[model samples]
Target: MLPLLVLVTLASIAALYVRGDLNPILCDGPCGPQYVTPPEGLATQSPDPDEAAAVGSGPIDGRELAAAVAGPLRSEALGGRTSLVAVDARDGKVLVDEGDGAQIPASTTKLLTAVAVLDAWGPDARFTTSVVRDGGRLVLVGGGDPYLTDAKSKGSSVERADLATLAAATAKKAGRGPVTLGYDVSLFEGPEVSPAWEDGYVGSVVAPVSPLWIDRGRVGAGRSTDPAADAARRFAELLRARGVEVTGEPTETRASGATIATVRSAPLSRIVEQFLADSDNEVAEVLLRQAALKAGQPGSFAGGAKVVSQVLSEAGVDTAGLVINDGSGLSRKNRISARTLAEAMAEVSSTPRLGSILSGLPVGGFSGTLENRYVRSGQARGLVRAKTGTLTGVHALSGLVTLSGGRPVAFALMSDDTKDVNPFVTQAALDRVVAAMADCACGA
Candidate 1:
């Protein structure tokens, strides 16, 4: 018990300090210091391949479930554009569709990003950032790891694929003194910001979509302007501190040679867990490109979007009305249907290779982006696992929930008309709707 308590504490501190998600605007104050009862049983093992089906495999009364959820969605705060869906995952039975069908998903779009990356790379894969030799120069290579931390960073294995680690090994191998440093950021291509994204989103909303970054692209209150360059420069500083001389500023390059030292990100499963729990925009963007590269496509906004669509098709998750202008869904041009979002949750719950996706969704009142949420939800606290989304007009929730009857259900609730409403009001309305589902005995 103490182990779990200590673990949760460390994770929370790291999240608060490191992820820089504490921005007053990005983190709704409701994502609390207000902790609730933790989950009944937090399983670390993999679920059965057919668990979603096994749990939800029964005659589902869709009408009963729909009737139960109707009143909550009627809340004026949600606006008229609300979209909702609840699917009995196993049988593909939808229990509700009580509002307009599709809307902007905001960070909930990370769900699609999660599915695409897991599908392409498999769960155990890790991203590697290496220090490689190029004649007298040492080139720091970015393998698209957004969690790569700089030296002197406080990190666990999952957080600190530290540049300091790479620097030590490089210095030892190079045998003393000076080396010109360059960075290879050719891994990702196209405009750093998606064409559909706002000009101001680059530093504030996310770091430039460079394959390399340190501290998850976080700078003071925002993100680094040139993440790749910033990372290279940080690496040089680490090397210099280690008594190795770095000649000149790190320059960009394409001619990287024999690897000097390599540091790897945590496996895809762990990476997926952190990014989803935190609603990390930077990690989502990088994963999009990584998946694109695996599929022989450009590792750019368009390419990642293309690969995401292809992988969803392969996983049998519907992508209808899914328009992805960028991997992170920061772009208002992105559009996804409630049906598609719910089905993606269903696939994550049901598929074997895709299993890690569910484990990563933030627990309703305990961790990640959800820490301050669900305070008003009764038994739903700590029981719900979902990815939350927030944009000016956009508010969304999508993931799995278990009914009072223990029937596991996949659901999505989304809206774009809430810009006129207080963000907290709309978010609370969505939570009430989900909490009602948790407490319902709809099968009877």
Candidate 2:
């Protein structure tokens, strides 16, 4: 062995090298190490085609894909007629098409409503709910803001226009004494409940469509009988709590005087996202009417339907043979083809104004309406994002899905005649079909 001191010095040098603090080859003072730089040509080497192919692999056989998904779609569990259409979101190539013609769309109709509203009012548009002075009475004017709330306004994204905020603003101008309180729902005209809708839809799936309502006219998940009246009562209560005494019960009237306090809603884009993600019927209906108002038509179910069709047609979507009875698709008479839904989704992907609609769709096995769905199949768990529609006999799923090659595909599947079959079974069948699309490497 060498001297102990030499050995210790050698050990220290080795330790320094190990710790990356010493360079053996450079002994000069403050030595700068030289690194071998890769050549420009090597740095920019073209990716191997084979490796690219492997990374972007997808289904190569369309026949095999059809065979894989056909059985579940044809299963008796899905009652009545079944219509489906899938297209490459990038190229609009038809991946799957079955049973043409219109079918009951259910809540998937909101997708159309969303596009129409976004077309009529750009994403940045905002709705305003205001309090104006009508003589000595304070009249709350509805601006067709669906997301308005009773809770204190948090910010732009959370709470739009809260009663507390509106009341506080109104209190400052109206002085302390008792004032007559009323609300103007004239912003929306026609029947509160759609004649085409089933009676059970009220107080269950949706409330009466109104220009102004708190929490989407919901006491919770359940709906209030007369949402506008309920909202007016709540507004009065808030005004009373704010030291502004209300003389009597609040009633509906038109505001034809100076404006006092105004509160704007969250931007239209955010409302569309929440409506689509949560499948909010009230929001959908309100947006439908709002779209009609924007289009210079009466804010009614018929007016909204006409405006929606007109707007979609203007957007280059084929509205031929399309019948929209209501904005929310609560009406069983509502008919839409899978091709139309897929086309609309494709339009959403291509159109800059409507692009945000895709992000609002529920991701399979992850968020929103589809959280509990796609649980049985891992294939579509994170890859598929869709809107689910369910009624008694109607089961529909439509949205976008990323394939094996990371290509996005838009699909719409509807089964409207399965009243006899179990709903869970129908949903499972639909899930399997969408999951198959995600797993497919067709034409890879």
Candidate 3:
């Protein structure tokens, strides 16, 4: 018995010697060792994809990439007004900078619009454009109709909440076979773009945002009617063609106290995701209105812009010189610095549900407005992920990208004018800067 006890003591000592050391878990705030108890049915679950990829991986070497980019991305090539800034989102470190302090976020300003909407309206909150019966007249109240169509191609198309569904629901809900449908566009103004917006830029590729339409009156050349109303009428005609009796002509009005039916929106997150992914001006405007409405404010651009500004200030983003003329960055007067954009990007990156606001951006050679713009070098091909902005003389890109060092980085580049320089040339230079960050390991 004594011998066995002695042997046990020796084994215990050997086991203690075998235990080596543990690395410290970095934390800026109060943190304790987490004791994770396996939940039922999750014992075999794998780690999250991002976490797993990061485990035990060393930082990537990006010196070559940075040097390569810095080589051709000449300051002289870009208009003097051009500015660029890149940051590592994972560590909040600046990866690259060229006049990052200068404020001029063109369409990239929509990112702020997206963040405001998401904060005001949680990810799953949806927009609703309603069709209701008021006494004998059918009242279609516009709840700032972001998605009010049968065109599945558009960001705001509502298949289940469209005219047919409204008609069907109206028929079933009222116990009456049919009702006179009255349209109300009073929910939003004719367009989200202010009357003060530059006249020459109107009716261009990206037009003003109006609540009651789709395509901003660019459905065809020189078109300027309400796209939503047109769609609703077409839908009504379709219903008539399908044997649903129509009694009154569709008329446009504002939202009223009478509401009979509503086409609800998908949650705010999904809608924001779609809008940010494509920089959909109409979606941005509608979302801004929806945010204002949700926040108990008037659903107008001014009200929404105020709320948006408040949201930014609350998020610790500096909004000193920021001017948001419209939800989309189509306005020339809209100004935001690269630093502000980078700051907003960083904050949103830290938020839980924003999901690859970085990943959603247009990669140099891959997607969105940049798809055809930057396809030259292999480094620039897939390394950059950013939002692209363009007006007569303005071009910009802002968002986040993963550096070769495996650090997620936030970046913004703005070009006011090329001075007779081709826009493509400026875009290529921006792509090179992004590629440099992707290739360099900045110890982030």
Candidate 4:
């Protein structure tokens, strides 16, 4: 009687499966009750707590932003002739504008150089430093890699084009003993030094421009007089270290034939970051010449300046009244308006190709050129990132900063023409102005 009862229950379960009236249970180890999926078009549930916290509030109020910056702009330390312009990066609306006319840009001119170079070559593009074998000679060709280093790596920084590595590889290909070493720097044309630059600038504020150099031609704090020759000499030393005997002096000439080994520069993006963050004058100059070459113009100061103006003008930024003497902005003759600088910042913020420029800016009270700035209490601190420029009475600060309401704004403040004022004072004034903008709650 018991066996018949069990059989009857099993037969009923089999009948339900055969009739397609049974719910399926899915399990890896043991079977569990089946789950009923919710019907389509069900009301959506809220996001988890972590995701909700990641969202930003909204745009800042322009009115409040203007109010925040007003007092700082009135500082007497900012010089008699001051030009300033701040715009909402989202819509290009002017938040603050004061004074007029062009002012000396100082190193902030590197911003213009950065844009022109990026326009000519995308961020991922890299400059090549190649060693080519022509006849009995080993030739090192410079592709204008300014940050090329001899060290394998500097701490955790990106690996640069290393001369020792290149030499070691080249020696393996070329038989040991009796090799003539030469370098080709003809990729760049015209004078190495910009004639428009101040006489004292060379070997002080900047080294003479050359495509082939190690450590920006610096022994330590001082610069070399002839960087190309010095670089070739260093290459010879590196070759000797690799058990290769070099015969004859290293001369400058173009290399033709098979490439032995090549090391590429840390991508253009990293170069831009280092140059802008450190305000590296020589790097800026080298990049300018490279930009000219890429644009199909002569790789000279004059040609670079011309192409930079053309590139910016074509991009719809007003280049009128803007004079670019040199890429590093060491020239006092280099003139730019606050409006133009602000527009350039806005362009970088909006254009995908130019976006990397913003990341290279020095963070306030944190890193690079701005490490010592914005240190005072109630200041912007890490809230601002900009390029600082200073020359005598001329001081300029320009870059992007987000307001309290999470809106990013681009600002440029140029103070010039004042006599006998301390540079630190002017810099402090400029920082205060930027801090005001960062501290704003504006149109929340």
By lDDT, who's the top model here? 2
Higher-lDDT candidate of 1 and 3 = 1
Q: What's the C-alpha lDDT at position 41 in model 2?
A: 23
Over the stretch 311-358, how does candidate 4's per-residue lDDT look in tens digits? 888877766589998899999999999888888898889998886688
The alpha-carbon deviation from the true structure for residue 281 of candidate 1, after best TM-score superposition, in angstroms, is 1.0
Residue 12 miss distance in model 3 (angstroms): 62
* Sliding window of 10 residues with minimal summed lDDT for model 2: 36-45
Candidate 2 per-residue lDDT over residues 20-53, each given as its tens digit: 4543244311122233232222221123466448
RMSD of 3: 13.6
State in Å the error of residue 306, model 2: 1.0
lDDT of 4: 0.80
Instruction: Evaluate residue 364 in candidate 4 and report its C-alpha lDDT on the 0 to 100 scale.
Output: 75
**Candidate 1 weakest lDDT stretch, 10 residues:** 28-37
Residue-by-residue lDDT tens digits, candidate 3, 1-444: 999999998888655433311111222211222433332322212334565465434443234334645665665556767676665576565555555444555678788878877788777666676666665566656555565555433223222245556555555454446656566666655344565467655555444455555433456665443565675576577556556566777776544455656666555555565566677766777777777767777777777778888888898876767777667766666778787787788888888766535445666665677677546553645556678777666777787666543456677778786757777677667666666665554442
Per-residue error for 88 in candidate 3, Å, reads 2.7
Local distance difference test values of all predictions, in order: 0.80, 0.80, 0.62, 0.80
After superposition, candidate 2 runs with Cα above 4 Å error: 1-52, 55-68, 153-158
Off by over 4 Å in 4: 1-64, 156-159
Residues 273-322 of candidate 1 have per-residue lDDT tens digits of 87887778888889989989998999998998898888878767667778
CA deviation > 4 Å runs, candidate 3 = 1-73, 93-97, 100-103, 151-160, 173-180, 189-192, 200-208, 214-218, 221-223, 242-248, 254-259, 373-378
Descending-lDDT candidate ranking: 2, 4, 1, 3
| Per-candidate RMSD, Å | 7.4, 12.7, 13.6, 15.0
